[model samples]
Target: MVHDQYMSLSLVNINITSYCMQFIDSLCYILVILGLVGNILGLLIFSSSRHTSKISSVYVYLATSSSIINIFCVIRYALVLHSKTRIIINNLIGHVWFACKLYELSFCFRLISSWIILFWMFERVTCVSKRLRTLFYRWNASQLKFIIPCIIIFIILGCVIGPPAYMYQPRISKNKLSNSTIKSMNYFCGLPSTVSIKWQKYFNELHLGLNHYTIRCFFSELFPAGTIIIFNSYIMYYLFRTSYQFSQINENKITKERQRTTSWMNIVLILHSCLFLSSLFSHVVGHFLSVEAHETWWVLLTVLGNCSLNFYVYCLSGKAFRKQIIHIIQRLIILISYKLQTCKQQQQNHQYDNFKIENLIYQSNHVENINQPKSYGTKNYPKTIGINSSSPISEQETSV
Candidate 1:
C-alpha cells in the first residue's frame, strides 16, 4: 500500500511537469509571433510622418532602437527557450565558440534594450517636470551623443561578462552498463566538470558567486528594478500634480488637454517598467532559491513576456500609437480593395476577349458552310452560292 502511494505520487508529479512544459511552450510560441509583428509595426509607426511631427526626433530614434533590439530579444527567446527551435539552433551552433558568442549576443541585446528603455523613461520624466523642461529641450538637440556613448559602455560590459559565464562545451555521455548515450544539449556551454576537483570547486564558486549571484542578481536584475521603481514613482507623482493643477484651473482647456496627453504617454512608460520589474524580480528569486522545473519555466516565461509586452502597452495607452495603427489599417483596407477591383476588371476583360474570339470562330464556320459545295443526289454544287445565283441575273442583263 505504501509503495502504491509512492507510485501514484510520482505519476502526479510527472503529469504536472508535463502540463507546465506544454503551457510554457505554447506561451513562448504566442509571444514570439506577437513580438515580431508588434515590433515591426512599431518600427513603421515611429518612422511615420505623423509621429515624427509630434514626438522629438531623439525620442523617435530611441524608440526605433528599442523596437529593433526587442526583436532580437524575442529571437533569442525562441533560440534558447522553445524546444524545437532550440534543437535546430543547437545543431547549427553546437561548437563552444559559436554557442558562447550567441549567448553573448543575447546578453548584449537584452541589456542594451533595457537600458535604452530606462533612459527613455528618464527623458519622459524630464518633459513632465516643469523645472527640467528647459534642460529637456537642450538635451533633445544633443541626446544622441549621450545615448551613443552609453550604448558603447553597455556593450563593453556585456562582452566582458557574457562569454565567460558559460565556459564549458557540450558533451555526449554514454552509459556502458545501460548501453545508451545521452544526447541532450540542454547543458551546452554550462559549467565545466571534467577538470580537476580543485579547479572545479574554484570554477563553481566564482561562477555562482560572482557571475550569477553578485553581477547578475544585483546589477542586471536589481539595479534595473530599482531604477524603474524610482522613475515610475516620479512619473505617477507628476501625473497627480497635473491633475491637481487641472482641478484648480478649471477654465484652462489647453492645460487639461496637455495633461491628458502627458498622462497617456507616461502611462505606457509606467506599465512597461512595471512588467519589466516583475520579470526581473522573478528572475532574481529563481536565481537564489531552489525552484522546481515548472517554476523555473514560469520564471522564464515572465522574462520573455516582459520583452513582448512593450508594443501592446503602447497601443493601449498612447493615443499616437493607436492613431498610427488605425491609419495603417485604413491604408491596408484601401490597398486590398484596390487590388480586388483590378483583379475583377482583368477577369472581365479576359472573358470578353474569349467571347469575341468565339463569335469570330462561329461566323467563320457559318461562312465556310455557305461557300462549301452541297451534295444533292450525287451532284456537287458550285461553291459561293450567292455569287453563282447572282451571275445568272448579271448575264441576262448583258444579253438583253
Candidate 2:
C-alpha cells in the first residue's frame, strides 16, 4: 500500500514539473529573442555613432554586456526547457545547471556592471575639474578607454565562471516537500538546496559548515550585491547634490557634463536599486516562505529580477542607443512597406506599357495592309524592350 502511494506521488510530481518547465521555456524564449535583438542593436549603434566616444562609452559597454549575459541565460533556458527533474544531483552540473546558477549570479554582477557605467559617466564629470581634467584628458588622449572595459569584463568573467570551477559543490540543502506544501502547490519547486560551507574556514582555519545554502548567497549573492549597492548608492547621492549646483552660472561647461553624468547615474542607480531590492526580497522570501510559493513565482522574481530592467536603462540613458533602436525599428517598418509600393507601381507601369504597345501594333498593322504593295512593316516595328539578366551581356547584334 505504501509503495503504491509513493509511486503515485512521484507521478504527480513529475507531471507538475513538466508543465512548469514548459511555462518557463515559453517565457524565456520571448525575452531572449527580444533582448538579443535590442542589445545587439545597441552595440552596433554605439560603435558607429560618435556621441559616446569618450571614456564613458567604456561604461556603456559594460552595461551592454550585462544585457548580453541575460540574453545568454535566456538562450540556455530555451535549450533545457524540457527538463523535469528539479535539482538533479549530478557529478558536475553542466549548461542547464549553470544557466540556473548564472541567472542568480547575473543579479550580483548587474550591480558591478551598473557601477562601472556610473563610474565611467562620473569620470566624464570629473574630467572638467582642472585637477582631474588632465588625467582623463591624458587617458582619452592616449586611447586608454579600452582598459576600463577590459578590467570590468575580467571581473565579471571571474565572478561567474571562476568561482564554481575551482570551488566544487559545497553543501546544498534539499527540502523534502511537506504535506501542507504538496497540498497547496500544483508544481514541483525546489530552492537552491542549502549547502553551508564557511568561507572564513575555507580561506582561514575557522570551522563552519560547508553545505549551508546561505554561504553561496553570501559570497556570490549578498557580498557582491551589497558592495555594488553601497558603492553606487553613495556615488548617486554625491552626483545628485553636485547636479543641483548646475543652477550656478559660473561653470556652465562643467555643469553640462555633470548633468549628463548625474542623469545617467540616476538611471543606473534606479535599475540597480530595483534589482538589488527585488533579489533581496526574493531571497528572503524564499528562505522563509513555503516551498510551493518559492518554487512557483519567487524563482521567477529572482530570475527576471535584473534581466528585464536593462532595456529600460539603455532606452532612457544612452542617446546613441535609443536613436539606433528608433532607426532600426523605423527601418524594419520601411522595408516592409517599401516593397509593397514598389511592386504595385511596377505592375501598373507594366500594364500601361503593354496597352500602348498593343495600340501601336493595331494601328501599324492597319497601315501596313493598306500599303501592302510597297511597304515593309519591319522598320516600324517597336524595338523589343531591353532584357535584364544577372549574367553580364556577352553579345550585341544587329538583326540578321
Candidate 3:
C-alpha cells in the first residue's frame, strides 16, 4: 500500500512536469513581452522632465536604471532556463561550465544594480531631514555634492560582492538521481578542479557572508517596512480622530477629501513596504536554495519574480503613476486619431481641388469656343445670330 501511494505521487509529479515543460516556452515569451513594455514605459514616465525635482529625482533615476537592469537580467535567465529544459538552450561553444560562469556574472551585475537603487532611496530619506540636508550642503563646496555620497556607497557595495559573482556556479545534485529525494536542487555548479585548496577559506567566508546577508535583510527591512506601517497607520488614524473633534472641520468636505487622499497614500506606502519585504524574503530563500542544490527552475523563478513584484506595486499602489500611464495612453490615442482624421481630410480636399480644376478647364474651353469663331473654309461669318434690317415678304421665306 505504501509503495502504491508513492507511485501515485510520482505519477502526479511527472504529469505536472510534463505540463510545465510544454508551456514554459510560452510563459517565457510572455514574460519577455511584459518586461519590454512595462520597463520601457516605466523608464519613460519616471524619467520625465517635470519629475526632475529633488523629491522625485532619486526615485526616477533609480527606477530608470532598475528597469534597464531588469531587462538584461531577464535575457540572462532566459538562456539558462531554456537550457535546463533542453529546449534549444545554447552552449558556450559546447562548454556548459563557461555558460554557467557567464550567466552568474550577468545575474550579479543585475542584482548589484537593484541593491544600489535601494541605497539610493535611503539617501533620499536622509535628504528629507532638514538638519542633515543642511549639514550635507555645508560639508561640500559644490552645488551637486549630494551625488558624491551615493557614488561612494555604490563603490563600497561593488567591492564587497563583486568577486563572488564569478566564483559561484550551478551543478546538478546526486540526490536528484532518486525520485524519492528532494523535488528540486539548487541552480549551483561545481567549482572547477583547477583551483587550489589554499582558497578554501575564501569559500567558507563567502558562505558566512551569505548567512549574514540574510540577517541583514531581515533587520533592514523590519524597521523601514514594518515599523513604518505601524507608525504611519496610527498617525493616520489619529488624524482621522481629530477631524471629528470639531464640526467646522468635519463640515469642510474638501479638506476631508484631501485628508482622505493623503491617508490612502499612507496605505499605499504600506503596500509598497509589503512588496519590498516579500521581495527581500524571496532573495533570502533564493540564496539558500541556490546554494544548497541549484535548481535551474527555482533560480530563474526567484530572480525574475523578485524583480517583477515592483512593477505590479507601482501599477497597483501608486496613484500618481497609474494616472500618468492613463494620461499618456489617452494622449497617444488622441494624437493617432487626429493624424488619421487629418490625412483623410487632406485626401478629400485634394479630390475637391482636382474636381474644381477639371470644371475650370471645361468652362474655359466653352468660353473660348464662343469668343473665337472658327475659320471654316475661310468664310467670314458672324459668331452671333443676325436678323435682316429690311424684311420683305418672299415666296419661299428666304432672301437673296
Cα lDDT tens digits for candidate 2, 51-167: 656646554565455555555543433333323433331212322445445433443444444444444444544543455667766656434556654676577557544554434
* Residue range 1-400, candidate 1, lDDT tens digits: 1111101001112222476666767888899999898888888888774655465556677778889989998887655566565555555444455764565445566666677777766666666676677765666645554757487656656544554445544433323434556442232343445566654443333223543334544555566667867888888787777777776878587777877877776777678777877877676555445322112555557767777887788678666678888888799899999999999999999999999999999999999999999875535545434433566655575566
How close is every model to the real structure, measured as TM-score?
Answer: 0.72, 0.51, 0.58
Counted clashes in each candidate structure:
0, 14, 13
Q: Who wins the lDDT comparison?
A: 1
Residues 1-400, model 3: lDDT tens digits: 1111101011112222576764665666666667667777777776773643445555566667777776676666555455343332322312366655564456454444455445444544444445656675677533343466457546644543444445644444333546576565333343444556644434422132433333333333333345444444554554565555543545677777666766675575566566555655554554454332222355455445545545655466446778878888898899999999999999999999999999999999999999996675535543543455343333234554
* TM-score, prediction 1: 0.72
lDDT of each: 0.63, 0.51, 0.53
Ranking of predictions according to TM-score: 1, 3, 2
lDDT of 3 at 95: 38
Better of 2 and 3 by lDDT: 3
TM-score of 2: 0.51
